[model samples]
Target: MSCKRLAIIGAGSSGLVTLKHALDRLPGWEIVCFEKGGDTVGCWGNPYPGFISTSTKFTTQFSCYRKWDCEADPASRAKREDFFRGAEYGHYLKDFSGAFGLEKNIRLHATVDRITKVEEGWKLWMGEGTEVFNHVIVCTGLAERPRKVKTHLPVLRSMDELPEGKGIVVVGGGESAADIAHRLAAPELGNRVYLSLKTGIRVSPRYHPIRGVPSDFLRNRLMLSIHRGLRNAIGQKFVEARIRHREKFERAFHANPEGHAKDEAINARRKQWDARLTAAAKDNLFNVFHTKSDEFLDDVAEGRISIIGPPKGDGFREFSEFDGEGIIEIEPDIVCPMIGYTSGLEDLTDGELRVRDFHLGCLHVRHADMFLVGFARPIIGNVPTISEMQAKLVISLIAGNLERPRDLKARHEQERERVEREFPLLNTEALLPVEMFPYCDQLASMLDILPTVRKVGLRRWWKIMRAPASTLHYLDDDYDADAVDSQRVHSPPLITGLLVLIKLIDLVYRRMRRRASSRGSVCPG
Candidate 1:
């Protein structure tokens, strides 16, 4: 087969996976990867202090690689320095690229300026000139732009303007806040730091549900039963909840219809959510605080941090000496904002790639010729699962083993109609919402259109079927004896019986409805 040319942007986790998948599927294809941050900072290339993946290493690793020697024990999670400091992950990526002869294809210190649609395909402008490619994949990681403290906290005015030796209050309750607090509390800094959390953040356990059947079993069962009718029902429920929430908000505000009451109402709602979130965070297994910002201010009154106004609906009110409270203030040296980030794809593309806003920044590419590999964000499923599905889909599309359904257009039209009928508000100009699990399942099913198993051992199958937990061990290509021994029996027959009973009830209900219709008279049982 003739080689095809492909260009990929950003050398982050997603970009590396895309390179690996493409090489496996299209061995003859000429691929080039571009990284703007030079060769020093992609994946494990650069190690920033206090850097660790939020995701476990098992879920984070590529499908082809297994981190654990045996499935009996969970794979150990790697700290930031372990994976990043010595360029361990970078070495892995380099080795992966070399294995597939991809090292020659990577171009470091290259930046993609814009992409323009051309007659045959697309043209990517990089550095001083342009490169034409049959296909282009954007693997820019999830964070589009960092959410800075200055942007979120208007009261700070400027980070540099803050005074020295005074405690700086940082608001936010996420992992970032924890890191910042740790930094401030360091002996070298010798500065008092206050963390203002409206509600506490929940820190996930190293592991979840030590001894219960995996949630995936239940979720899969529910998903399998979601036929067209169930989909309409689910969609309608979502619409109703949205409408009800809006109505409740309007009622609570009780402002003039012509007046601008939205801001106040939104603030009030935000405060309520903040309170609930804070409570949840406190009650979490970890040491999350449930105290209000005002309580923290009380501590400030005792020479902790300056007392800002009592935590009001719209965060702590901005206080000045002009106000009644005579609070002594000290300037804080550094203000670390733990605000989140958005996917930074706006400047990466010149609007040539269609992004579906609802899918958490997924590109809208219907053709098998163009595949989006790893765009799902904040999803529970492992990254490799989605990547593998994408790889298979693209492979099938390229090999001509799978063809777009003849009724694809009609199906899409029907889906639109269904959405409109069930979710009128969602029918607005915004894109259709696609959750991670459903998207993964859909992609997997599509790729499975042509069933072909590479190879599998009986021991591996038994281990996978009996595994009571969701782990990457199941997805690994290598099979180990310990993995098989650690497996547990499937859920008892009682649960299966209950499911069968529910199906039978539904069957009987449908039959009764048919009989009632056959008899013109209202069938009085």
Candidate 2:
């Protein structure tokens, strides 16, 4: 095969995996990966103090690389049940590049300012001058730049600069705001936090419904199918059931002999949430982004962190009249705005960014060779694993090993519609916030790597069915199948039985529907 030149922007998890896969599939190809940051890991390259990842090691690690033994690496400060610290995950990414020999292709502290189309391929203008490549993959991540507000109350962008023993107001209803508020309000920190939510926020436990197992265990294929099948008809009820399951687990875990003293605060918060939801009937549970934090809400209940706005459909009040010195009347020592981020792809694409611009949020619809990887955010599941799958798909498309969709526009529209229906609050057009399970399976099916019952045998398939949705479940070119199986966690007896039953029913229903459709048609079921 002739040598092909490829340029990958951003050396985070997405970029490293893309480089590794490219080296493997298109050996001898000239690949250049540019990282604006001084390090290899993109997201965790520079993290704030006391930063912990929402994702667990089991689910977050790329399929090609396994074995994140925190016991061996005490610096990580993580256990089997604990989530990875930002630096620890960054270390893992660095190790990943080393393991796959991806460092040689990576250029650190190299920023690509502009990418333009050329007769041969694409032109990237970086600080080191111009470079041309046959293909360009933009893996800069979902948030190109952090969203900021016009506030003058000692705004702090990075949490690393957060001060203690002072009054703080954290803006935004997302995970960052919740986590930061929780951190600052801890008794040792001696800081009173006021969380200002623009509208309501969804909160889920880090681990609940089952102890020792991440709640993401509920995102198995069976649950995903059930959710997909039922969401359109009764999305509200489906979401309610999910909440109830989490609540049941939480109540069980927090039940204590102190006359449920801890329960008082939680119940108070629940009432506040219920009243707010009742006031705004349009903003159902489905639309809001669920913030996964174990102690954020607890802090709110215990009077450590007070909630502002998010009551009766009102958002955080604007601070239009700040004192001359940029001091607010409330006089908070610091104001942290975790509002959101903007998709920094306006220069790359024409008009506003939309789902129709890319197929599977990886391959660009207009340019066959161009791809936008790691922009899709999963509602539940690991992002690095998803990015790994995207890397495989991109290589397959470039190698002509996989066929592009004939109706690419129509497929994009369908996906957009699905995301809108399921996650209404999420803006459907721009950045992709996916359902995770079905999305991963969609990519896996395209690569013909989905772990079907026949492929892994019925026994192994059953184990997978009852376990957390690990990207490792899908067989990989690297890593032993038995080792992957050993890492997979089987749910408790009741949860396992329920999931198995649901899967069996879904299978039978699918078979019946196929049979009914094929009764008179010439096509096979």
Candidate 1 per-residue lDDT over residues 330-353, each given as its tens digit: 344444555444344455554434
Q: Relative to the true structure, how large is the alpha-carbon lDDT of every model?
A: 0.45, 0.67
Worst ten in a row by lDDT for model 2? 320-329
Candidate 1, superposed: residue stretches over 4 Å from native: 1-3, 40-46, 69-88, 148-166, 171-188, 196-200, 207-333, 357-370, 381-385, 405-439, 449-525
Q: What are the TM-scores, per candidate, against the unseen true structure?
A: 0.58, 0.81
List model 2 lDDT by residue over 244-322, tens digit each: 4545654554411111235755766754553353233335432345667646766766788876653221122333221
Best by lDDT: 2
Top TM-score: which candidate number?
Answer: 2
Clashing pairs in 2: 12-42
